[model samples]
Target: MAAAKIKKGDSVVVRSGKDKGRTGTVLQVMPKEGKVVVSGVNIAARHRKPTQVNPQGGIDRREAPLAISKIGLAVDGKPSRVRFETKDGKKVRVAVKSGETIDG
Candidate 1:
């Protein structure tokens, strides 16, 4: 797998989907699946029919995984591509648009 441009805790913006253009922090990264879970985005609601596990199961709402391609690293409130560059003898992520270095 290539290097991860967007990691957990990264601020990202949805490129397309029902939540297009929405911004949120990345809650999880599933590189193996090529998906990511962002906070307050792509929420899926499940209605439970009351089971032994949960007697009064009304609804379960939570963030769902979105394709990594649907998201971009947020830079200055906008979506931007990320690139890696060697800085100070270490690798770091940089915003392609504004040329700002993200935390290493």
Candidate 2:
């Protein structure tokens, strides 16, 4: 497993891919796979097989996992690199671009 800078609820912007430049919230993180699923990004359709949730079993559209390297964390409304820093004796994530604390 690897450490992931992006976590659920964090805002991010796609750096490269079909979704490039699009900003969305991080819905899930897969550090083991180096992938992260962003809401409203990398959408794909899956054909259902008539499950209880939907008897009709129509196609379902959902966000797909994107390579962790393909996205950048959004801080201060801009995409930026993330770094850890100690503030008031507590470690937190900091945005390299804006020098702002992202998480406490």
Candidate 3:
């Protein structure tokens, strides 16, 4: 496997979709599926009937998985491409816009 460009907890911006221009933290990364679940982005609502376990089950709203290609790493509230760079004998993700290191 190669190094992951995007990981959990990474702030990212939606590149193309209904939620384009929206920025959020990455909650999960499914490398095998090439999808990612981002907070406050790509939300999906499911209408369900009441279940025996619980009482009300009107509409369930939650973040939906988005294709990995539809997002870019965010830096300072802006979207930017990421590239790996070796510094101090360690690999780090750097934003192309400001050339700043991205926090994990």
Clashes of each: 0, 0, 0
lDDT for 69 in candidate 3 is 90
Candidate 1 error regions (>4 Å): none
Model 3 pairs whose backbones collide: none
Pairwise lDDT winner, candidates 1 and 2? 1
- Residues 1-104, candidate 3, lDDT per residue (tens digit)? 45679999988999998999999999999988889999999889999898897678799899989999999998888888899998888888889899998853
Top candidate by lDDT: 1
Give each model a TM-score. Answer: 0.95, 0.87, 0.90
Ranking by lDDT: 1, 3, 2
Q: Evaluated with TM-score, which candidate comes out highest?
A: 1
> Please, what is the whole-model Cα lDDT of each candidate in the order they appear?
0.94, 0.89, 0.89
Q: Candidate 2 on 1-104: residue-level lDDT in tens?
A: 64577899999999998989999999889998899999999999998899787888888899999999999998666689898888999979888898988877
